[model samples]
Target: MRKLVVLLLLFGTIAHSQTQGFAKSSDGTPIFYRTFGSGKPILIINGGPGMNSNGFEALAKKLGEHNLTIIYDQRATGKSKLEKPSEKNISMDLMVDDIEQLRQKLGFDSWIVLGHSFGGMLASYYTSLHPEKVEKLILSSSGGIDLELLNHRDLVQKNLDKTYRDSLAYWDKKIRKGDTTYVTKLGRARALAPAYVVNPKFYAMLAKRLSQSDRALNTLVWLDMNRMHFDCSEKLKTFTKPVLILQGKRDIIPAELAERAHKVLQNSRVVLMENCSHYGWLDAENVYFSEIGNFLKP
Candidate 1:
């Protein structure tokens, strides 16, 4: 019995948060989550609000070597359930609550929250609601909810590439002329959006998966996030947790916004991935991992 007990303890301590699917959200959405390693918990909030739990595969592996890394498919994305589109019921606040619920369910009292793009905005709101729960904050290719920065992003997109520039011009002309289904025909590959891909191999894999996706959740969530345009600059200043802000200089999001956000944070550091695009994880994986590891280190 003593030997068996010791063996069980060792397994429990060494085992990663065994990747599992569980029913946590009260609304009946089955959130899928995965984890590896065992240390300070790091929760990764994926972009798109509708993006799946897959993009973080590379990131998880790197971080999982030391820290307990947790990534979940948000309520309406991936394998999570979605509700009928409505006005008041589906709000960002609810999404925040879901994160809190997931954390509580996972037996974590506190966690390092990571948000990328829309996820970053979500994290800002999250830190506001539960400042005490966040051990640290990491924002990647994102900033506080500033719609103006998106306009700045538009200008930056103009100088990206000759082909890309012309395509945007054409798309803009069509959209301005009342072409509602513009992106549907042009596809994501033609827009300023596609320039964000840093790795062709990864891009190809995503493209294949995207083509096979049964739902338009990712695209819809992106539009919803833009339309929501969550403004929490006031709340951003209230975050007491140490923050690490990351942005790509060549990104449409613009690294300057990250600098501005860094100023508002209580204790924050900005990491500009030079000449990289929005997909800094793949664009500058080594730098990103090193920086993240440094920030989380004891």
Candidate 2:
């Protein structure tokens, strides 16, 4: 009976244990990563070129219930900070390399890759570079496979009233001028928050997450992408792995972008959630989890 009790305790501890650490990238940048559960690995890449991995912790824990869920701060964000932020240190190629380094450090020959928003673009780029390292690809409210998404005006701009737009412009100017204080960041995040979800209740939560973004890093990535003419369409066409494209019908990123990717990816499925915006989990929770859970099932 005592042995049985000990075994139960051991199992309980194992079930809840979380592993976290930093993995050195090719350029020797320490990328922070955390893992939950245990099984086939699924790396959850959160949105934002400059946002840290904190916003996805809840989502990671939920997915971790069955699969070994991994979430990491991309270089120059959260715990994965470079000694100095520069175009040379941070770029599309280097960012992709960081993901590869993390995979190697984790000892994953190949794993399921799930990326959200901007992360979708990054994941698609990563798959294009290293198709053999990806078992499956899941894009959630993705930014699409090319820079075409940038040509369209953000839904946030349309959703904002003159007052909010003015506020956003003001804060943005301040941020660009090297005034990235908490107040400045929060101001910009709040002004742009409404367009992120259909439900108003989630605005504050989304705003808080957005406020944590690193503006300088975000700029660096965008500049680098422009310099390299970042486009994954050609490479994505050659990828034969299973791909799932999940987008909210009412998202800031248009449905056409998702469709474009669907047409490009050889073996891809696209699901559009109704009454949802940029965030499907927050706006259409059931549909979001259901689609992903079903897709990831063995």
Candidate 3:
């Protein structure tokens, strides 16, 4: 009877660690995440300065099968609550602080951080700030890291054929006037443009998530956060772990910028997909999944 009780206790301890979470960010914004599988922990952050968990469900399920992945919505987005707006607070630093708190609360000593788009920007910045906490890093179709993207957005957009890009003129008008809602609307067009394995379902799901999001300054999610402020690029050079940067051939971030990040990182690699736009995962879902899967596996 004693032996059986001991075995049960051990099993319960292991099970509890495999998948659990119910926490909050430093601002008291309620935060939630799920841990699945059992192995090295991989924390996945969703894109969009406003995207929540639903945007990452497909990618998370794929990663969870191999390593324990914790996916959470950023504060004020999805189900998570954000800190009340304040003049001196609520900066990107706050975003990184939220990640740190969530990880500590979940008992993950370390994690392989994966961020997509805006999340990619956050992950790179976070890894730069706390290289000690990250085991590996992966970014997909992100425009956040390259400061030059500001000056070169035309070159980035020029990658698209004239016929297709003409559709975006409507967006340029809205962006110049300081509109937020239209920025979110263009996010789908930006993400799901090419005529390939386009998933209306995914786009619709993403749209729904944005509609319900507490997104403020929607345009800043990728560009502003992605920008390396005073300590960013200089700090990114300090990362020693392996890095993988995945970009679409026609995606907004210049192929050159991806190369620049690789050149700066202690060790990194870049993969460009053919006939794909910004959302390489959707443009080349199978390849994207396999690329990240192989890199994250032990």
Candidate 4:
């Protein structure tokens, strides 16, 4: 009876460690994070200058099956809150610092870093700031190491016909008028969903995820990034660590952007997924995971 009780207690403690929790950032802001699986640590940063980390939960779980995967809400998104989310509280430097602080709290001296979309930009910035702390770098549908992505017209928007554009405009007006209900958000997301995925079937899922974004944070982050002229290309040139730039051929973000990153990153490799869009995992699940799995292998 005593032995069984001890074993059960041990299992409970292990389970607690694998679940979700908060890590206080440098400025004492509690950053919400969730962990999955067990092995080498891999921190997955979701995009959205103001987006929460929930959208990456499925990806994290898949990665977690082989390694310890960590996903956290950025400073002001999801469960992570800031007392006053002003320009002073949020900046590119602060965002990078938050990742470092989380790393310290998590006790990982160095670990794999994976960033998706805008999250890839954050990961690049983080790597630029602390190259030594990153064992490997994975940029999935990344936004490149510079701000050039903003210069290009959104392919998704361009492809959208007048009807979709009109719908988007309608939702934008509602959102601007402070109607931030899920319905309004979902409506906005649905309008943009078609461009996000290659298959129409995944449109609803993509829209659901897109609707969860925190617009204020997104705007704030972009504002800060633009002010700082966010560019890590020079720093990445000096980084000799292994980097995997995985992008989809048909992604709204053009393939040339990934190629440009590959050129600047000294020790980087680019893998373009044919027929896949921004979300390669959804568009080409087997190939996506296979490439990631192989790259991460010892």
Number of clashing residue pairs in every model? 0, 0, 2, 0
lDDT of 3 by residue, 1-298 (tens): 9999999998656544445455777767677776765677888887767656766766666666666778886766666655554423346777788899998997877889988766777788888788899999987766556455566746534654565466566655664676657554556355334321234445555445545444453544433444535235778887778899998876766777788778888788899887666666777888888888778767
* lDDT tens digits, residue span 91-143, model 2: 98998999999999999999999999999999999999999999999999898
Candidate 4 per-residue C-alpha lDDT over 76-166 given as tens digits, one digit per residue, 9 for 90 to 100: 8889988778888898888888899889988999999999999999999999999999999999999889988988776878757789889
- Runs of candidate 4 exceeding 4 Å displacement: 1-17, 161-163, 176-179
**Residue runs of model 2 more than 4 Å from their true location after superposition:** 1-10, 161-163, 166-170, 173-179
Candidate 1: worst-modelled 10 consecutive residues by lDDT: 206-215
**Looking at model 2, which ten-residue stretch has the lowest summed lDDT?**
152-161
TM-score of each: 0.80, 0.93, 0.76, 0.91
RMSD of 4: 3.3
What C-alpha lDDT do the candidate models reach, one value each? 0.72, 0.90, 0.69, 0.88
Clash total of candidate 1: 0
Candidate 1 lDDT by residue in tens digits, 185-289: 344334444566655555555444333333345455445556777566777787777899988777757666787787789799988887567777777878888
Prediction RMSDs, each to the true structure: 5.0, 2.0, 5.6, 3.3
- Candidate 1, after superposition: displacement of residue 245 in Å? 0.5
Model 3 ranges with Cα > 4 A deviation: 1-20, 144-146, 155-215, 219-231
| Pick by TM-score: 1 or 3, better one | 1
Tell me the TM-score of model 2: 0.93
